[model samples]
Target: MAHIIMIHGSWSGGWMWDRVIPILTAAGHSAEAPTLLGADPGGSRFPSRPLTAWADQIAARVREAKGPVVLVGQSRGGLVISEVAERVPERVGYLVYAGAFLLPDGASLGGTIQSAHPGAEPIFSVDTATGMTTVLPEALERIYSKTPVRWIEYARAMQCLEPLAAITTPISVSDERFGSVPRAYIEATEDQVMPLSLQRAMQARLPCNPVFAIESDHVLPSSAPEELARHLVEIANRVDHPARLRRPVL
Candidate 1:
């Protein structure tokens, strides 16, 4: 069974994965969805942290795992997971991007998003006085209309600002170390936040093609946990099955 490290996107804590974790555990896989710094509602009451700090948190988890782990990143969390893979590729079994933001070397997450799709609204808005940033609730309607209403409400309630500047900075991963690890991407067909065209475009940037697609919105793991879990399991099974040198055509 593969050990998995799950990360949630902007304005969300690990709670976002609550629905999906059970499906993975029931299937005999071990997974951990730790809230990012400044994200956990009940954790330490410290000041907000930076993106690399969040990436460092995940790296620590990867280092502590008993064996190689599959890193699952959703939305902005995808950026963090990729950075972790770049830094500690030897400990990572696979890098799974779920409606994730995939960046090239030396690219900042914000800059990459701006370059990839111009005219998109900032996912996080900042308040200079307190140095806190929060995601706008209106954006959720655009991003997660297909998602359950309650889940959206919960996400909005937990919407805290991340250090946007810090998150956008480029990070490094050794090519010799991480280049060969298996990778998977899950496309949310109805995702308005990251459109299907963008999702396909992001998948194209990956070294290998992704293994599955769910015709739901951005919150597929919460909206359709069982289905998402099934796809994840399929990708996990392919760990032993040799990867096809050629990419699969959707």
Candidate 2:
């Protein structure tokens, strides 16, 4: 069984993966989604927390696991996992980017987004005084277009403010470490938040083997949890027991 660690993106907590965890566990794989620092709504808001702290949190969890782990990052969580893999490359078996930011060294989330879609900022309100960024309820439909309306309503109620530092901070990764690990990318075809064009551009820069695509929006874990779990499982299996092509015997 593979140890799967799921990291959520900006403006989201570990609870985002609630639907996918059970499916993975039932399939005989151990999965855990830990809330990243500065992400929990009820917890303290440490706006000064750097991106490294976020990555360190995940690396710590990976060290606590019994064996090597398959790290899956969604959206901004991709940046966190990339740093985690850099820190503990030996402990990670596979790196999966589920429609996430596959950035290179010295790239900040904000910088990358702006580069891809100029003048495009997060669909949220930032309180400069408090250093907290909040999502408006009305924008839920735009953020999660493919999700059920009922689920969107539920998410709107549970959503919390995200730290501005986490999104603006630039991450550093090395080719010898983060780039050496096996990786896969799952593309959300109908993603409104991160357009399919940008998703393809990011993946092209940091290519993944056996890339998979799903006809869902940005909130894939909630909208298409089963399909997401299936792709993850497939990647895990391929990593664990790679298929071999046999040569014909004359």
For each candidate, what is the lDDT? 0.73, 0.84
lDDT of 1 at 32: 84
What would the per-residue lDDT of candidate 1 be over residues 76-177, giving only the tens digit for each residue? 877788788767877877788887776656767667667767988765677787555666766778767777888777777766556555555675555555
Q: What is the lDDT of residue 63 in candidate 2?
A: 95
Please name the candidate that would achieve the greatest TM-score relative to the true structure. 2
Could you tell me which 10 consecutive residues in candidate 1 have the lowest summed lDDT?
A: 241-250
| Alpha carbon lDDT at 162, candidate 2 | 81
For model 2 the TM-score comes to 0.93
lDDT of 2: 0.84
